[model samples]
Target: MNLEARKIEFVQEFLKLQSEEAISRLEKILRNEKKMSENRLVEPMTQDELNNRIDQLESDFQNNRFKSSAELLAKYE
Candidate 1:
């Protein structure tokens, strides 16, 4: 079968799971896999590029151009 079909079949079988421990293990695996995939999407930055980005951020903060993390999150909620 194709990838999508296999995924659907897997989900169907997963839903029929009766063991709580099994489910918990699967949940942890899925979460870690997802986190790994997310981290893989970001390209690595060089040390000089990293320092320049940090410097720009500090300058922005000094000029009152930066938002706090809480403020940035609050807008989404």
Candidate 2:
């Protein structure tokens, strides 16, 4: 009923899965979950140029001329 109980039920059902298709789906889910979790683990910036771009963004925000997230993202396309 609750989130933790649902997670436990999911784990129990997952452990009981015997079909190859079910296993494959579970493996894909686990791999994607691991990739997402790894992205949450931050790596230090080793590039000075990349750091300066971040600093420029900070300066732009302070100057009230920074574009919105949607506008900034659209430029890449």
Candidate 3:
């Protein structure tokens, strides 16, 4: 069977079980699946990267290399 068909069959079988123990097992399986999915996730940029970006922004601002919000909007109109 295809993935979607297998999923539907699994859900149908899960519904048919209808016992507290079965439900608990399904919940544990879902939780583990979620954790496994999350395990493959990547972390955001490090604090050092963020600090460097902020420092670059501050340097640009000090040198008037950045435009004010009003000046940016004026370009659009």
TM-scores of the models, in the order given: 0.62, 0.49, 0.53
Put the candidates in TM-score order, highest first: 1, 3, 2
lDDT score for residue 14 of model 1: 98
Runs of candidate 2 exceeding 4 Å displacement: 43-77
Order of all candidates by lDDT, from best down to worst? 1, 3, 2
> In candidate 2, what are the lDDT values of residues 1-77, reduced to their tens digit?
99999999998998898899989988999999999999989787779978998899889999997788899889997
Predicted structure 3: lDDT: 0.92
Candidate 2, run of 10 with poorest lDDT: 42-51
Full-model lDDT for every candidate: 0.97, 0.91, 0.92
- Tens-digit lDDT track of model 3 for 1-77: 89999999998998899699989988999999999989879578899999999999999999989888999999999
Reference-based lDDT, residue 11, model 3: 87
Instruction: Give the winner by lDDT.
Output: 1
TM-score, candidate 3, is: 0.53
Minimum summed lDDT over a 10-residue window in model 1 is located at 59-68
- Scored by TM-score, the top model is 1
- Please list the residue runs of candidate 3 whose C-alpha ends up more than 4 Å from where it truly belongs after superposition: 44-77
Better of 2 and 3 by lDDT: 3
